[model samples]
Target: MKYPVLFSPIKIGTMEVRNRYVVPPMATGLARADGSPTEGHVAYWAARAKGGYGLLIVEAAAIDPLGKGSPWDEPGIWDDKFIPAWKKVTEEVHKYGAKIAIQLHHAGRQTTHDKIGGQPVAPSPIPCPVEREMPRELTTEEVYDLIEKFGDAARRARDAGFDAVEVHGAHGYLIAQFMSPYSNKRVDEFGGDFMGRMKFPVEIVKNIRRKVGNGYPIIFRLSGDERVPGGRDINDSRLVARVMEEAGVDAIHVSAGVYASTQYIIAPAAVPPGFNVYASEQIKKVVNIPVIAVGRINDPLLAEDILESGKADSVALGRESLADPELPNKVAAGLTEEISPCIGCMQACAGYLFDSTKSNISCLVNPFTGREGELKVEKAEKSKNVMVVGGGPGGLEAAWVAAKRGHKVTLYEKENVLGGQYRIGAIPPTKQDILKAIRYYITMGKKYGVEYKMGVEVTDDLIMKENPDVVILATGGVPLVPNIKGIDNPKFAKAVDILEGKKEAGTNVLIVGGGMVGVETADFLGEHYHNVTIVEMLPEIAKDEQAAVKFFLMERLNKYGVKAITNATVREFLDDGVVYEKGGKEEKLTGFDTIVLAMGAKAYNPLEEKIKGKVSEVYVIGDAIEPRKTLEAIEEAARVAVKI
Candidate 1:
C-alpha cells in the first residue's frame, strides 16, 4: 500500500466507492418542514458530489414521521411523496459521477414530534435528558413494525436510485437507545444485557439487507462512546460492530455521542482533533468490514494520515465538507489554496441548525458555500464599476462576488491589512488557522481583479469621489465600552488589544465578560500565563454560544485552571482588581494585574442610512447592520450581492 492509497477504490458489497473520501451524513435540517426534500437540500448535496467526493452520504432522513428528533425539518423516506424528491437528489449526484447513499434514522426518545405532530417512541419509557418529555414505550409487536419501517425506508432509498442505504445506529438514536444501558432500562429481551440490547440493531441491518436484496450495500453507523457515565464505551462498541458485520452490514460508519450528551456529539474545543479515531481503530480490529471515521477530521493531512495508518478504511468529513465542498477535489488536484478551512466554530452549521435559523449554512471564509449553483460567477451585463467599503468578511465576500461576475470591484479598508477582527483572532492560540482563511480571501480578491486599497478608509467624500454605480458598506462594528468608572483609563484594554499585543498584561488577568470571546481568550491566556479569571453577571459562561462550543470552552477552562464566576456583577474597577457583588454579598478582591473587557460588540450603522438614499444601490452588511459571527457576515453579503 502507498501513501496515496487513501484515495484508492474500495467495495462495500455490490457498490464501489471511486475513492476512500466519504462525505458522511450530517444533519443539516435542509429539508422542508413536512419531511420533504427541498431545493436547498438538493443543491447542497449536489455541490458535494460535484466537488469530487467518492461517496456522498445524504443527511439523516427519518424512517417514520414519529421518529423525528427535533423540529429540524429533516427529510423522510417512509412516504411515497419523498421518493420522487429523493430521486432528483440521486440523479444530480450521479450526474456528478459520485455514489450516493441515504442514511436512515429514528430518534427514539430523542424525538419531539414538533414537525410531525406526535409523541416520541423509544425502546423504554424514558425521555431524553435535554428534552424532558417522556417517550411512549413500544410493545414487542410494535417493535416488529418499526423494524419493517426501517426495511421500507431502505427499499424506498434503493428504488429512488441511491446506491447504498445506511442504518443510523449511533449517537443514542433509536437503535443506540436499544444498545445503551443508560437509556435502555427495559426488562424485556430487547433491553436486558449487551447481547439483548444489541439484538435490535442487528435485526434492523438484517431486515434492511433482506429488503434491499442480496448485493445491495447496507452501512451501519455506530457511536463508539456514549460520552456519558453508564453509557456504551469502546469495548461495548466493538462487540456491536462485530454483531453488525455478522448481520450483513457492509460498512461501519463510526461517529460519537448523542444530542442528549451535548458535549460528546459536538466535542468541545478542548477535545483534540482526531480524538475519536482510536475508537474506530478499535472497532476495525474486531470487524472485517471497512470502518468510516468522522469527528473533526478537518485537515486533509490529518485525514490522509488516518487512512494511511489503516486505522480506518475511509475519512468522513462533516463540517469540513460544509465549509468547503471542494476540499477533496482541490487536494487531489494539489490546489490546496482553493480549500476553505472550517474554523470548528459551529455557529452557522450546527448552531443555526439547532436554532432553526432560515439562512443557509454559511462558512466564515467560503462565501460560495451554499449558493454554488445559484450564485455562480455569471458575466456582468454592463460590467459596472463597484466600490466596496471595509475589508472584513462581508466586504471581502462582496468584492469577490462582484469581481467574479466580471464587475470592476474596488475594496478599501482603513486598516493596514484585511481580516478586521479575524486578524487578531487568528493569533488566539488554538485558532491560528483562521488567519489562513483571511489570506485565502486576499489571494482570491487579487486573482479575480478586485483592487484592494489598504490604509484608506471610505468616507462619504471618498465614495462621492469614486462615483461608482453601487456602494457596499461592510464597515464592520465597534467595541461597546461600558459606562463604568475608570473604563476610560489607559490601564484598561480591549480583548483585541490584548490579542494584537498592543497592550501588556500581567500574569494575573481578569476578563470582565464571560461570552465566547472572553472565555476563549481566557483559555488561550491561561495556557500561556499564570492565572486568568472570568467575571460574568449571567448564570453561565458562554451562554450566547452554541452548547457544543460551550462544552469545549468549559472543559478548557477546567484544564487550564481558569476561574469562572456566574451571577456576579462588577461593581467597580479598582487599580488592582474589580469589586463584585454575589449572593447579596459585596466582596472587593485585590489582584496584581491587568483588566480586559470582552463584553461584546456594537453594530456600526452610522453610515447605513447615510449612504442608502444617497447612492443608486447601497448595501449594508456584516457587523455594520448587526454584530454577529463571521459566517453571518459573509452569508448576508453574498446574498445581497446576488440580487444586485
Candidate 2:
C-alpha cells in the first residue's frame, strides 16, 4: 500500500478494526428532541463506515437528560428507551465491516439553564468564563451517582451494538471538569491535587470495566493540554493517561482545548493542519495503550507519518470527515485528488451548531454532510444541457454536481483561470487550503465531464445559440466602489487587484475597509514589507469572520504592525491618503504613497436580467443574487444542482 501504516489494521483491546482510519466523535445535531438518533444521523454514520473507516466513534451521548451540553438535538443513552434507536445506527455502520464506539459525555458547566432546564452541574461552583454561568457543584453522594451513570451508559452502548465506549474526559465537559484544577475547586476527594482531580475519570473507567466486562473495549479520550490559564497541561495529561491505563482503558484518544480555547477545538484555516501530533506523542510516552492523535488530521500522508513515527496508533479525521466521508475509500483507490478537502472555514459546521436557529450541521465544501439521507445526486431522468456562467467556487460546484447527475454541463468563465475571487483569496499566508478546494472543484469538474470554455463571455445571444435547457448564473460579485469625492484616482486599485498581482502599492499603503478581504489584503501586503493601515466604519474589524479564524488573523495583524482605524470613514479621497470621519470629527492623513479600496463587494448580476426571461429555466445563484462567502454560494449551488 502507498500508505502502509495508515492502512494497517490495529487492535484496541478485543476489537480488531479493518484498518487504522478512524472518524472521531463529532456532533451532527441531527437527533430528535427526545435524543434519539434520527434517520439522517444514522445515514451520516453509516456513510462514513462505508467510506472505509476502520472505526467510527459516535458523538457525545448524554448520560442524563440534564447532562445535555451541545445542541438541542444531542444524542443520549441516559435511558434504555434510547437503545433501540442507537442500535439501528451501529447495525448500519457494522454492515460495512466497521467497528463502532460511542463517547459517553456530560456538558457540565458548558451548558446553559435553557439547555439543561436548570443550573449546570460541575466538580466545583466556579463559573465558566465562556458560558459565564456558575455551575452547582455536585454533592459527594451525587458525584458517586454520576460515576455509576457513566458505567451504566457504557453498558448501554455495548447493548446497543457499539463495539467500544469512550469516556469523554476532555474539552471542559463534566469528566474534564473533575480532571482540570482550573474548574475543580472543591475541597472534597474529587478536588485538590493532581491525584484527586484524576479520581473521577479513573473511577469512571474502572466502573465501566466492571459493568461492561473485560472483553468489551473501553477508550478514554482526554485533552493532552487544556491550552488555558492555570488549566491542566501536558504534564497533567501524561499522568491522566497513565492513570486511565491503570484503570483499564483499552485505548487513549488525545484531543485538546476547553471552551475558552476553542480555536484548538475547531482550529480555523489559519491554524496549521495536524499541529497537535506532539500532544499524542507526549501522552504516548506515559501510557502503554494505543494513542489516537486527532487535530485536523486532514491529509493521508500526514496521518501515515504520525503512525510511522510511532507518535500515534491511529489518526482521527473530524471536520475533514464531514467534508469528504469517502476519504479513506478514495485514498485506498489512489484517487486522493478527487477527495474534497475541508477548507477549515467553519462557517457551516461550528457556525450552525452554535446558532440556536439552526437545528443541524452541514459542510461548506459538502452540504450533503448532515443531509446524507435526502441530499444525494443520482442520474437525472433526462439529461439537460446546462450552461453555468462564471468559474468561482459556486460556479465550479454547480457545474460539477450538475454534470455528475447526467447533465451536459458547459461552464463559462470570462477569465482564463478558474476559482474567480477564491483564487485571489488564497494568496494570503497560511491559506493554501483554499487553493486545494479550488483545485478540487476544478478536478471534479473535469472528472464529471464539465466542458471548460475559459475567457468566453456568455452573452444572451450566445446562450440562445447554445440553447441550454437550464441557465445557472453564478457570475459572482464585484468590488463595491464607494461614492466618495475624488475616489476615481487613476492609480488606485481594488483589494482583489492587489491580491491578484495586477497592482503594486507603494511602501506606505492605506486600505479603505476592514472586512475579511480588506484585512487579508493588508496581511498579504504587510508580508511584502508594506506599511499597512486599515480604516473601517464599524467599531470592530472582521466581526463577521469566524472567531477562530479572526483570532489567528488578528495575531498576524499585530505581528505585522498593521494599524487599524475603526469607527471611521473616508469623506474624501486625497491625493495621497484621505480625509476620514471618526467620532464626529474629520481627520486627514496624507503620508500614504498609495491608497487601496478594500470596501467589500456588491452583487454583479449583469446578465441575470438580460437572460432571465429569455432562458426557459434561469436561476441566479451565488454572488450574482447576493454577495456573501463561498459557503452560502456553494450551498445554494448544491441545492440547485441536485434538483436540476
lDDT of 1 by residue, 544-630 (tens): 777776766677678889888889988888887788899999887677488889988998866666666677988888888878888
Q: How high is each candidate's TM-score?
A: 0.93, 0.98
lDDT tens string, model 2, 1-644? 49988888899999998888899998889888888888987899989999999989999999998899886578899999988999999999989999999999999999989887899998988888999988998999999999999999998999999999989998999999999888998888988888888888888988988999999999999988999999989988898899889889999999999999999988888878888899999988888889999998888989998999999999999998999999999999999999989988888888888778777888988988898899899899999999999999999999999999999999999999999988888899877788899999999989999999999988888998999999999999999997999999987889888888888889999999999999989989988899999999999988788888888989988999999999998899988998999989999988998899988799988877778777788888888887988888998999999998
Clashing pairs in 2: none
Local distance difference test, each candidate: 0.82, 0.90
Error of 2 at 367 (Å): 1.6
- Residue 539 of model 2 has an lDDT of 98
